[model samples]
Target: MAGYEYVSPEQLAGFDKYKYSAVDTNPLSLYIMHPFWNTIVKVFPTWLAPNLITFSGFLLVVFNFLLMAYFDPDFYASAPGHKHVPDWVWIVVGILNFIAYTLDGVDGKQARRTNSSTPLGELFDHGLDSWSCVYFVVTVYSIFGRGSTGVSVFVLYLLLWVVLFSFILSHWEKYNTGILFLPWGYDISQVTISFVYIVTAVVGVEAWYEPFLFNFLYRDLFTTMIIAWILWSPSDILEIHPRVFYFMVGTAFANITCQLIVCQMSSTRCPTLNWLLVPLFLVVLAVNSGIASSIENGLLYTLAAAFTVAHVHYGVRVVKQLSNHFQIYPFSLKKPNSD
Candidate 1:
């Protein structure tokens, strides 16, 4: 509450609202999912805070994470090279993840309907999304058969790093261009994760690790696809449009390298609070790589906890900065004053 500004009920009706523009390219999300979420949004009560929806969705992911930690055989040394995760767990995780995915869209619509849209909402949504990306990937890795090995863990960390980089780059683009340019790969990745969960439930984890034929395993094929996507994704975006390329790939890479430079030089004028982004990301990668090499489940959970705490601190700082810049309360739930 120290960083939060309060608005009286009498002054709640006149605050300006920010427009939301997410450039989604997945055909299902654009044509079907958005409409479904909008319909769900219409039924949400006026007083329901958008931040609550965002937080709830994130909590669901957290729950699934806990479940994985407790039940995943690959997560601990007690069951070395043993995988007995129940089919029901995969089903539950898949349903929860999909619901979370749906709620991610719903929260923005709820904010607009209630006239509570704010930069805090955008930051909160993306912040949770960044963590969710790691959680989902880790969940898959726990069951990935070859995931416990050194090389496999490195590959997993690389994948997660790219995912996080893409998420942060989108925010940097918004800061520079004032548009939330969602990439097509984001939608594809979400759908792929959801599908992986479903497939795991149907076929079980062994199928994923078993050799298909002539020593080629499903995991090998999946890894190849991931690497191929990383290489080809830019060209694919370039084919779609140059502007999309500029925002998604061009600025993304630029931010990865030069964002800290800009932040340092412009801190007096811009005051970017999340200056630790790159450093913390590197720490996470290093820590996870060590854990992977040691196959230490305890260290993995510790890393997760550390990442969560760091991000929460960073998020609060960002919200405070945005609140001051905009002269509005952070995470306010009430309708703005109309007078």
Candidate 2:
């Protein structure tokens, strides 16, 4: 984490001239989430670092993912003849997810409240969020990928890519347009996923196996809700470690978004395609090339691991570079040197 400089001298200079720019026209974010965040931000003391709040929210989502992974590693927990995840886990997930979402909504306000807003905070927040887009979605898929009404893991895999695309698209929009038009779907997706989690807790996973209308199972309803958010806004290969595939995709997108954030802060043009995606594309191709399942699984794991290491290394270096450039600690509220 220390003595690393992945960001180039040119990029460091870019950071010197960086200025944060963004726009949020999202109705939910503007009208609902902002007001809610305004109230919630008051709960924290001024000394609290916004990055801490952002990181805490991210950990909650990670905890939810771990919980689901332990209980339903195969996404078949509710399939007949398999053990169902305890109802209480779902209840806990629901509450924790809402809390995480709330923290995400308010972290920026906390930054402004303390008068400590910095490019590092924005990078840290959005970078964690890029990964979070995967974790929470994978956690929620447990609800739809259970029992007789289960959506195919393949479908869910594709859905995860869509989620990543949405995330990167918003950042990419900022890259090109110079203002992030916060996607309308983001708020809707979070609220809907949390609601589904609680409902699953109340009615039990089996209740979701029943059809809702004209043979459209609750699983379809769930996936459709995700799709609906896309059409109005003009928006995987499951089996043998679906989440690894998701991790690969998520990291690829995260790198893209993080780079975009750098460019956004530095007022530079972001590349249209990231070199990281080249390896990701090759891995995806090899995995789907009818290769042996053992080999496919191995490839997924290797790619996921590679992407994670690279993304984290890049993130650390970028943060360090920004901290040096700005003369402020990454996750601290300490004042810069006055001498």
The best candidate by TM-score is 2
What digit string (tens of lDDT, one per residue) describes model 2 on residues 18-124?
56777777787888888988998998988888998999999999999999999998788867788888989998999899999999999988988988888788889
Question: What TM-score against the true fold does each predicted structure earn?
Answer: 0.63, 0.83
TM-score of 2: 0.83
For every candidate in turn, the CA RMSD to the true structure comes to 11.5, 6.9
Question: Candidate 1 — which residues are off by over 4 angstroms?
Answer: 1-21, 73-81, 147-151, 209-308, 320-332, 335-339
In model 2, the runs with Cα more than 4 Å from the true position are: 1-4, 206-237, 272-294, 336-339
Q: List the residue pairs that clash in candidate 1.
A: 12-336, 12-337, 13-336, 13-337, 13-338, 14-336, 14-337, 14-338
lDDT of 1: 0.55
Cα deviation of 212, candidate 1, in Å: 14
lDDT of 1 by residue, 150-234 (tens): 2243344455556656666676676566566788786666667777777888986655553221222223222343334334343
